[model samples]
Target: MSDRNPGMELDLEWVSRVRVNTQAVLKRAQQIQGRKLVKKQWEAAWLLRAVTCIDLTTLAGDDTPSNVHRLCLKATQPVRYDLLKELDMHDKGITTAAVCVYPSRVADAVKFLKAANSSLAVASVATGFPAGQTPLETRLEEVRLAVQDGAREIDIVINRTLALSAQWEALYQEIRQCREACGDAHMKTILAVGELGPFTTVYKASLVAMMAGSDFIKTSTGKETTNATYPVAVVMARAIRDYFLRTGHKVGFKPAGGIRTAKDSLVWLTLMKEELGDEWAEPHLFRLGASTLLADIERQIYHHVTGRYAAYQELPLA
Candidate 1:
């Protein structure tokens, strides 16, 4: 919709040749995480950037309108006002990039944001999120329904079966259809890397998703037994780099699931800056699909500004 990264035709041959060196990926991940920490003044700035890139999320079995409203309010003002003021960032109008919810809750998020007079985007996970085992038509229809319900961003899962079987063309076509169904809303294709076997498969799936017109390539759904890890992120980031080299399009990358703690946010932001440069560090190009991560970030920021640890209640429920 924003015309940021219009997808291109699937090049199966190019995709087939994709390979990843597991050892190199693991070593790089370690190096990135072990790199000198951003200290004092600069650390706070990096955390603030992380706040902007968060897709503040809530997806659970018992998610209600009440909780969803609370989540929306958190998304509207992720860090407390006093914390922002202490950090001298209050006038920056800081907010999370978007609010991610299940398909059923998309309208609730939209309505809440409207009532609050906030322009935050709403992202809904569809197409049988987490597993993606539904019929193809059902999946596409799910996307359409979410769009009609006022979701500005659609986070659809890729059929892991297709990727596991090396069915690159089939997977590409499926994602292409989902993109069409998304219409103007930005489409984020979740690779569910944990189910896809190895780093090579993750790399290939990332390429195929980009080729098929995914506005963003997400690492996991947060429902898998094993969710996002640094090794997996390194592979996906390299894949994004390769995609940019072959095609002029810049596809965004999101590492969802198990990303808690302010340190986690800093590591991810550093990864983006190192792999994709400064541009990819922005919310439009990178997102941390997290709910609890926000609380940790708030706690860290409060500590950084005030030099005192925040009580649990001091941070908002995210």
Candidate 2:
């Protein structure tokens, strides 16, 4: 042992290695296919840390009254409704940040969600959803209806046709209108990254939406065939992180669609942590728009906390 304390030497060595590894991971990520977009996925791993909730947005299609009622009861029937709650009581995992639902079903979502936790937000889909091809007027109306119905967050898909067409002006106007329609509600502009031409287009669209006042930039609606990818998310995250660095305003990110496993969530979380740091970890800043992903995370947690595999039926569902 040198003059320095052995413990001090170990601490310094560990810190140095952590710095080196973090830098290497980030640099390697940047060189990857969607390197520019992987920031959030990596950052989320460490930022918010642990498991995050994913709203399976399209799980209930064409929200008719009966369907809405059923979903409402299912989402907010109380954890006490869960048999597992009988034995131990505490805030289980992370509380779901929002109850995502269709615009027409916002009111029903609001009713049950409020009963569960008043602060928990109600998010609604709008602006032509998966296609995002509706006329601007129709899209605005969609947003209006959702807000009026009590949705505090609105997710609108970008008009990819215009984006791919390189009609930045048209795309900018559409997002601006959608943002305006949101009024006080949080506006998340979905780039539909997979179908939006290229990662470069994703970056430009993200900038345009952020300029037009998007509170968050989402990767997909979880309805698209290609949904979200690590590369696409990397591009979007870099844009937001860089924007914050230059403008002093932090924006949120949501990588929706096709993300369904604890490992998948971990990949995004790792991206977020490595790219954006800890500030973006909370539900407010980072969210995985997944419907079936949470249960898997719960299962993993159960296994870790207790030494046995958690049975499927025994686990609670949102």
Please report the candidate that would top TM-score against the real structure.
Answer: 1
Candidate 1 lDDT, 230-301, residue by residue in tens: 999889988889888988888999999999999999999988999889988999899999989988888888
- For model 2, how does the per-residue alpha-carbon lDDT over 84-175 read when each residue is reduced to its tens digit? 34323344543556667878778877776566554567788889887887788998999999999898889888888987886766777778
User: On a 0 to 100 scale, what is the lDDT of residue 160 in model 2?
Assistant: 88
Q: What is the C-alpha local distance difference test score of each model?
A: 0.91, 0.66
Which 10 consecutive positions of candidate 1 have the poorest summed lDDT? Answer: 1-10
Error in Å for residue 182 of model 2: 0.5
Residue pairs in candidate 1 whose N, alpha carbon or C atoms collide under 3 angstroms = none
Model 1: what TM-score? Answer: 0.98
Error of 1 at 184 (Å): 0.5
